[model samples]
Target: MKFPEVVSVEQADQYEQVIDVRSPAEFALDHYPGAINCPVLDNEERIVVGTLYKQVSVFEAKKVGAALVARNIAKHLDEQFSKNPKEWTPLIYCWRGGNRSGAMTHILRQVGWRASQLDGGYKAFRRQVINELEILPGRFQWRVLSGETGSAKSRVLEGLAAAGAQVLDLEALACHKGSVLGILPDQPQPAQKMFETRIWDVLRKLDPARPVFVEAESKKVGQLRVPEHLFEQMTQHSTVFRIQASVAARVDFLIEDYHYFLADTDTLKQQLRHLVTLHGHEVIHHWCQQVDAAQWPELVGDLLVRHYDPAYLKSSNNLFTGFATAHPLPADKLDGPGIARLVDQLLNLQG
Candidate 1:
């Protein structure tokens, strides 16, 4: 059977299915946003093939690799593609629009499905991501929520989203809260390319005419860096909404919001260790002791005053041009009702 014609990454949505025929590790690194991983060569198998290609002849390597690819593709056909009708159309791609994708496209086409390869494969999609990141962020009008740690900016962003305001929750997407202690339990951050793909997905969905409400964030959120162009647009073009809440109120909010820390004192202490260089061993040790003693409020209050607030103030003042004349909205508490009131105020300001 003949192989199908290649399609661009931009045309991915036109197909009913998007299959990534790369190794699992490659897919984990990045692929088309919704592409399903149906690896023709898994990590270990890929290593074996590469080793054979270098040590043995290319002919010998292809012979062994072909068997492995056939077996895996057959398994996918029986297990994953069995339900598809003859009319099922899928877009397929590998690392570089090469043999891995071509094999799958040929097989699926032989089965009477209209399967097409992604031209330039994942590489093309990556190049598109790079181009979009450079230009797409500038297309949106952004409204940024800026505040100290525990000031309920995330909650406010959620409230804005729930209130039907277009919102971009970068921390949520990154699965980290943009802090030393922000690592989510059991959830690892996505690979850098995956992170960029997620951003591109969201950016593409947004209406450029409408303003996107986003939280103020540092360039890096945990282990992943925000795309340079998006970060630039966020810092330079955003109209800042500064949330106002007292230290005590913020502490109360944190105690309620981050109650997971109370249950996992050891983890909290370990995260606190990261701050030792900035706050010094003596201060971190004291904070750890406070955690050990179960003095939640006191520990949170001290961290807010000593560590988070000063750092936030310095960075926000220096980095965000709109910080000086930011619109102030009082957040008496970080509860639903309080956030709802703030959302109303925000919408009214926009109106």
Candidate 2:
């Protein structure tokens, strides 16, 4: 049978299955969205082949690698692809679209199923992501939600989305809250490429005619940086929905929302340690003591007044354009009903 032809990653959706033939570690780092990993050579096997290629000879390496590859492929054929219908058309890719994916495609075609390799592999998909991000930001009209930390901007975005508003919750996408202590309890952030892919996926689906409601974020969310074009567009937006809530209300909201911290005091203290340099050792020591003593509301209230609020004021005023004239949306509380009212107010005012 003839070798399968290479297809572009852009045609990914048309295929019945998308197979990633890279090593598990490579796939874990990043892969095309929705591609399933069916590594022909696992991490250790790949290392052995590579070491053999360096120490012995390319011929020797291939001799060893081919057996390992064949065995793994047989296992996959039995376990993963045994039940597939004859008409199954799968798109396969690996790093640089080279030997790994080619082997899988060849084997699958020999099994009488139509299979195609991804042209340029994961590299090509990455390039497409970069190209899309370079232009996608300017395509949407944005309405930035500008507010201090604990003012429930993320919640507001959620409520807006529920109300049929076009919302882009970057913090949620990043699996972070966008602060020194923003790391989620159990959710690890996606790889940077995957993060870009997620942003690209959302941006492509949004209607340019309608405004996309987004939070005003710094250049970085936790460890991931916002795409430059998107961050620039967010800052340039003149239509801002400034959320106003009393510090006491924001404290109450935060206490309820971040109850995870109460369960994991050590992790909470560890996160609080990051603020030590900024707030001084004495202040952080006091904060830790509060956490130990279970002074939840008082601790949150103090952090807002002393640490978060001032930082927010400076950053919001300096970084975001038209902050002085932002449209005010009063939030008496940060509960569901309050957020619903805020969402309604936003839509009514903006509409």
Candidate 3:
């Protein structure tokens, strides 16, 4: 029996196995979460066919693609379908749910398993992700936290979440801290579709009636773009908590938090270099010397004052002037009890 394409988001979500029929390279660059790569035609074959379609004719391209598709499907039937349990119902997709997924479904059914195709393939799912993100913030309440760099915004989000407040760490969702230095040591960011899907998953599970605390951020984090609709809601629907601290205290906090950067002076130097265009060569050079000498606190202060401070001042002046209230935590001195008190006050303020 020939299966139809175009399942709803709920139906797609319910499928046991989500298979990506695109090539491994295509899958690696970006794909749906939990999707397995089972190419109906490998990367080279796809490229060749595409080139043929452009250079020659659609008829010739289809002729070549058909032969390659049959060959690849046979391989998958022998190697993969034979191993899976009888109950496995795989939902498959290609770039646009064209020939690739159709070919795979044909083979899977021939082997006696129910295989289906996603409507409009991965592209359609991506559209749904965008739509969901667009509508989410309107359906939920937002409590925003704003502060200078190294003010531990992400940490505060985690703490509040632990304390039973709904929270969305947009940076964590993006696999980036939303800064130049945010790239994790070895891990790469997820694809845009996967990022949106992850965000939707989190949003879907949240209590919309409760306020979710989030940090103030721009529309883009690393390579991923936050939906403009959600961002617009973030700007209007949220109340801001300003966490203020003195330069000295903030520098100390930064040093303690980012000690790993101190281990390798070169890493700090490279990051500092990016700031040199704004700060000038001599200023960054002197700071690099301070970093080399293990004057971490001093280095942190200089970098912050030179770079983060001005930006923060401008942003703070413009945004959240109507914040519900400002709860000033001690900058120069912070401990478990003090932080607990601050958090308690913030939560109480919510009530």
Candidate 4:
């Protein structure tokens, strides 16, 4: 068997196909971006091998684990990678760049495929993401879009992105709308590491010379925390734009954005239960009754009036230095045309 060639995390992008040789559960948590899983031991098999290593002996574990790894790799070679041309080069990785990836890399090389293993594996990619995230945020001038819930700030940010402006849509990345009720129907928020990786991935490709447009957020979006440097630069050094709309307009927009919750009142009421401590039991019960009656407009308006608006006003004033002198942008609606017009107004502000 040819010896495995180990490549550093920095050289990861040089390959067209990056294969992860870790267990599926590990890959599901976080992996190098664009890396495909071709796990050699799978979930249950890994547990069996680890238990054997502790209970029996390293020799016994290796004997069984190697057999399993060889069987799986042979299956992948026959099924997933049989037709690769001689010029096709691939990178493989495992947790800590250990024996799992090393064995596979050796096998591939021996088969006349020039396969390389990632040095230090997924951990190295994570470290690179962390280090890059720390520096990348300060490199760009952030323009923070500040507004209460339902003010169409997110839509406006989307419009900017669609128009080819550099934007970081944190809610879209997190898969939660930044509230207790923010969870999407079927889309769960990613692991916190994956969230940071996503941010790092987007930030690395953006032009630092241009301002990055982002929606104002608290330290956490859903359960995902924003990187400290990125949050600091945005609140401390960025300019703020108040995306303004009338309370009526805001209520309408929110009803539309959160329409998914409208269809599933049981889940909506369950999420509303989290507000009992802040809003009190009576208020929470009344909101639940509104849900029972399908009073979406009223409930959304009440939420904005009693919950989101005051919280936003206090937070925005306290957090953003330029919020007092923030540019007021009156958005007619949060619809496509309105968002497009808002983007035009925002770009004009840039000039």
Candidate 5:
């Protein structure tokens, strides 16, 4: 049969195909980057085996499992693996680098291909991801850019990236803006596992000899958790750049970014209600009435001063007191060109 040795995490990067032999449900929850699910046992079959493992003897479980495994493998060879040649090397894994992978590896080998199993299965791979996030910081340099909600931090990162500056756009990788309104217009945010994959892919492409620019963010970005290793690196290797704009200019920037406000009043009302407790009932009531009257500028001004601005100022004052450096953009009469100039200036700064 198809007996194989375990492949380490470092070795995983070199593999062409990463096959996950877990049920589709398990694969949906989270899986190794680049892994495609080709379950040797579907969910119901796995549950049956697991129940047998508890109620019956190991020999009994193996007897039932063997039959299910054989049927599934034949189906896989017929439906999926039939296209690939005998020489294709595939890295296969399951939840614990156990029977599922062993079964698949054996089947693949029977077809004359060189295949391997990931050591420890997906769990071991996850451990490596956690360890990399926790321990691998002393080796690289980082630059962090800090600003309030409408400070154009994402745009600055994009500009820096365009100019060949080493840049890590965490929000872009996570597919969310790291805020309530951070959702993109038409695209859905990626699953957390996919987010990690995107981050890892970008990191692999970077030149460690150059400094990387990233935006400041809490560990959680919308629904995704920032990888611990990368977050740890940001905590220390980071040099911060602060961008400043006046209340009016920031309001304009926010309005431009959130076009949903232009089309739906109900959506705007729901978003506004999320801030009611922070702004207090009476003030929020006034804003609500004003909004219904279509007083956009008045509503924005009050919300900025009474809500978003105060919160941002408090956070900026408390956490970024000793920022690496700060720069001010245009105050009155601000526009895209002025913002672009500010971004250019911030990118010019070296850590």
Candidate 6:
């Protein structure tokens, strides 16, 4: 039998299964992409061993921690790996390629399955993600798709992706719609570290030769900020496309898109309250009255003209210099068929 190999984060994907042996809390924060959590020391057990390490002697701590690690590894062998073939190779990692993963690797190798531990473990993986995110955004040819709310920019972006165009959808990654009213009801955004990992995951697979379509998003999406270098690259160099649709089309699209708030006027009123400082209490209160009366068209029209349009114009012009001369692509139809046509138009667009 041979000693287990030591692998690095970059080569982790070549393994049949990448096993994360960190505590659940550590795994939840972030781990290597496609990694499975089979923690050697779970949450409570880790704390117990940590306390003993501090208060008791090193020998005492190792005795307890070793017993715990042994039991967990045995449990994994029986419950998780029982059905695997002898040829199955797995990559394992802990906080810093230390005793936890080393113990698992040694045991698995003893079982005649090829198992390896990651060098520098999760810390090394995170550093890789950080370093890649720093420069990856510049590698792509970016087409900044800009539009006011309800222009169906998000929907069109989805269509573009389905139609075989490379797309970097920031709002989708952030699990938000990217506005004061953008929070998804059932979807929560990932933690910042996990978010960066996901971004890096998508970028590393994309070819730099293709143009990646993305929305004109602000620095922050919901509570998460775009990686600094990414935001900088997006704002500095890109072909900007300004999508135009009639105000009526926008209103109709918004009512359908935000149907959740329409049914829950209390939520709609609360969201409107957030806009009081910008549009003044009187205008906001008037919009609330429209909400209570189920006057969506009137309320939505007022918002687009008063709130969404002006704010988008100001921000887009300020952040993207190309916005002053953005290519205007008009789509009065925002329905399913219209989105399809828009996708065709986007693929055929020239600078």
Model 3, range 1-351, lDDT digits (tens) per residue?
333444644577677789998988888766777788889879999999999999999999999999998988788778877788877788889988878897887777777777788878888877877778878878887777777888777777777888998988888888887766666555688877677778887887898878888887866788788767777777666676777767776776677766767776787688778877777989978988997888877778877887887876676556545343545544443345545665676788889
Scored by CA lDDT, what does every candidate get?
0.90, 0.89, 0.76, 0.90, 0.74, 0.89
Task: Looking at model 2, report the run of 10 residues with the lowest lDDT sum.
Answer: 1-10
TM-score of each: 0.97, 0.95, 0.85, 0.97, 0.83, 0.94
The true-versus-predicted C-alpha distance at residue 94 of model 5, in Å, is 0.5
- What's the CA RMSD for each of the models? 1.9, 2.1, 3.2, 2.0, 3.6, 2.2
On residues 1-351, what C-alpha lDDT tens digit does candidate 5 reach at each position? 342456777788677789999998888767876788898889999999989999997889999999998899899889988898776778999988888898888778777878888888988877766565454443567777776677677877887788778888989887778775566666687777767766766776678788888887876888789877677677655666667777777778777766666577666777677766676778767877876887877777777776666676565555443353544444342366766676567666653
Q: Write candidate 6's Cα lDDT for 1-351 as tens digits.
A: 332479878778778999999999989888888889999899999999898889987788899999999999999999999999999999999998999999999999999998999999888888889999988998888899998889999998999999888988888888899998898777888888988888898899999988998899898998999999888778889888988899999999999999888777887789889998888989988999999899999999999999999998899889987888988889978999888888888998832
lDDT value, residue 235 of candidate 6: 82
Worst 10 residues of 4 by lDDT: 1-10
Name the top lDDT candidate. 4
* TM-score result, candidate 6: 0.94
lDDT of 2 at 314: 92
TM-score between model 1 and native:
0.97
- lDDT, candidate 2, 219-310, per-residue tens: 88989999999988898754777999999889989998898989999999999998877989999999999999999989999999999999
| Model 1: colliding residue pairs | none
- Report the C-alpha displacement of residue 137, candidate 5, in angstroms: 3.8
Order candidates by TM-score, high to low: 1, 4, 2, 6, 3, 5
Q: Candidate 3: give the clashing pairs.
A: 6-119
Which of the predicted structures, 3 or 4, would earn the higher TM-score when compared with the native? 4
Error at 330, model 3, angstroms:
5.0
Candidate 5: residue 324 lDDT (0-100): 35
